[model samples]
Target: MHGKIPMASYDEAVASKLRRVSTDSLRFGIIALIAFLTLVDLFAAQAILPSLVVKFSVSRATMGFAVNASTFGMAIAGVAVALLGRNIDRRNGIWFSLVVLAIPTALLSITDSIAMFALLRVLQGLCMSAAFTLTIAYLAEHFSPGQAAGALAAYVTGNVASNFFGRILSAAVADGFGISINFLTFAALNIAGALLVWLTLKKTDRMMRIDADHPPVGGAWKAHFKNRELRGSFAIGFLILFVFIGTFTYVNFQLAAAPLALSPMALGLVYFVFLPSMLTTPLAGRVARRFGPANGIVLTLGIAIAGLLALLTPNLPIVLAGMALIAIGTFLAQAIATGHVSRVAARDKAAASGIYLASYYSGGLVGSFVLGQVYDRLGWTTCVVVLVAALIAATIIARPLTAPRV
Candidate 1:
């Protein structure tokens, strides 16, 4: 028959190409390791929050300060990395950052004073921010357009998986061995991640060649911020992360009180809700490609709002279901928004990624403190209301993404 090649043949060809590219390039490995390390850092802090509070005799407000300190450091480091682009070898920057990150992470195990622990976390945040930004930039630069979304999704999956594993592992270890041991184990994981990056991840010499041709425009940041689509995407990222991190940070505290009275391990089970994100992120990307990022974002935000509202009901199963919905929505929003930023950024994909990430972490920092205080004063109902408000703001901002890119 004189017919065109079968669609299945095209699919096989694409899959074969992807396998070859992934095997030949070290970028995928680097992205995976960075994602792993970032999770380690995130979970190390989160897993220990309840234990730290008990050990140090600190209030939720103070714990919020600790969380803010780390995120604030991440924001600062993100800005610095953006400015330092091309001036430094991206590989060297990431490696140096890994070393810097290791010092503080390792020290967290030995530190007795809350002050010292917080300081270490802040330093860890700085190092991790730089490492993460560079790694993400490298992946975007190295991968082809066809593969970029999947690569980013894989990286994000690493992050979501780490969130699930980190908390569960830390809580389990804390239950059996001790909290200190849990921190130490995460520190070891960080070190291992660093080594994996250093050894297996190829130096980005070839990738740098690709990025070097697209030199930075002097005021690229200004140009990027001017894009309505990017601004909207960024806002969505900021708001969604603010609510997501804030809720996760304090969920343990909420559950530990009257009605639920869940143990640390039981509370850690909430992270299981996040597992769906790993499965949903790639699907979200496909949906975004078909329906457009704006539509995906709107749908996801609506789901998130519903999830937040469902928390108002006092049923545990309902609350868990709500949390799952929130996870799916958050991941969908993140995948869509991040893809939007990468596509619409004027120049310097790394810098754009840095800006987006900086906004994201800044929201976490601000939200952690602000929402924690809100919860302290007004209770869980007020906190849910705040999250719903943030989601509404996200929906408003996301509307701009539907506008023709200027």
Candidate 2:
């Protein structure tokens, strides 16, 4: 009888151990945290742009391009990873890329020339792309099919959260300590990201080693180019960021220089505008499902145009309201357009995404320079007019993104 009782206790203990080992909640948190660290440094530089201009003693346009040069490297890395990711080990690539990322982010503090600064920014972009690319792969491999959707949603929420909080942190650190120290703070976050991934993430046995039998990129792209919906999506993807980057980049100068005269900390807090976007963007897939991608694009970009017009208001509250609308509209539009790309490509979908991202970020790089010149020469109102025109063009391009008339 005693021996039988001991066996029952042993079985109960085993069952309890199995129950204790559930990692679903932990996995979601880890994925979101790592994504946040990966992208926290991306656009945070914009918060400190005024300080950087003073530090480098350079033109606003020059500083703007240098600050945005990260997009250039990101564009190249997106395509490279799409082609080469099958060979990369997701577990090691994510952690190691973050470690390397810290080096460039730290080095940014000591750079003295615009040329070098831009180069380091490019390096940062490369490391971030590798980490982000591999993380997406990791999610697909690690999570169950039932859990993958929620996991991806968590990762994207982290990215959006970083955009909102990262800038605030950067501005606060620069205001209190110094701009150089701000880079060091970000470097430390990079190290934390590496350690987090190293400790928690696991490798999957189901490796997607497909380079041995992959299709030719040149042939695939040619086919993708022939599709009208794909073509329209690619263009909309480009124009979305063109207007977004243009409006956000130059508006800082206007806010800091004139009647508003918001301090660095205050300007950083201005990104509170993204809160509505954070809330609204998660519903983008639902919006597309209900209204269809074509109508979703038109509806959201219409909100953006209304926001651009509101920027002409003389009142501060109205101006902030305008910025909030732009954030909500553009972010939702981007989510819709990105989802459209995934649907319309039909084959080599990863490569199609790579092409779309390259075009999207390239628009940001181009917008930084083009709109900087516009702001410097023609002033804020002309810049708003230019952005409004860009959004209008994007709306026209998105019209053909569907076959059935909407």
Give the per-residue lDDT of model 2 (tens digit) for 208-305.
Answer: 44334546878778877888888888888888888988888888887888788899999999989888887888888898888888889989999999
Total residue pair clashes for candidate 1: 0
Candidate 1, residue 292: how far the Cα is off, in Å: 2.1
Give per-model TM-scores.
0.87, 0.91
Which residue pairs show collisions in model 2? Answer: none
Residue-level lDDT for 167 in candidate 2: 88
lDDT of 1 by residue, 1-406 (tens): 5345677788889999999886745555556557877656764456546777888888886876684577878888888877665555666677777776777776777787878877887888898788777777766666787677667767887777777777778777777777677767777777777776777656766433224456554567777788777777777888988988777777667666778767877766666877887688768768777777777798988988888888887678888888888888987888788878877875676667778888888888888888878878888889998899999889878775752355
Worst 10 residues of 2 by lDDT: 205-214
Best by TM-score: 2
lDDT of each: 0.75, 0.86
Off by over 4 Å in 2: 1-25, 209-214, 403-406
Deviation in angstroms for 200 in model 2?
Answer: 1.9
Candidate 1 lDDT trough over 10 residues, lowest sum: 206-215
C-alpha root-mean-square deviation, each candidate: 4.2, 4.6
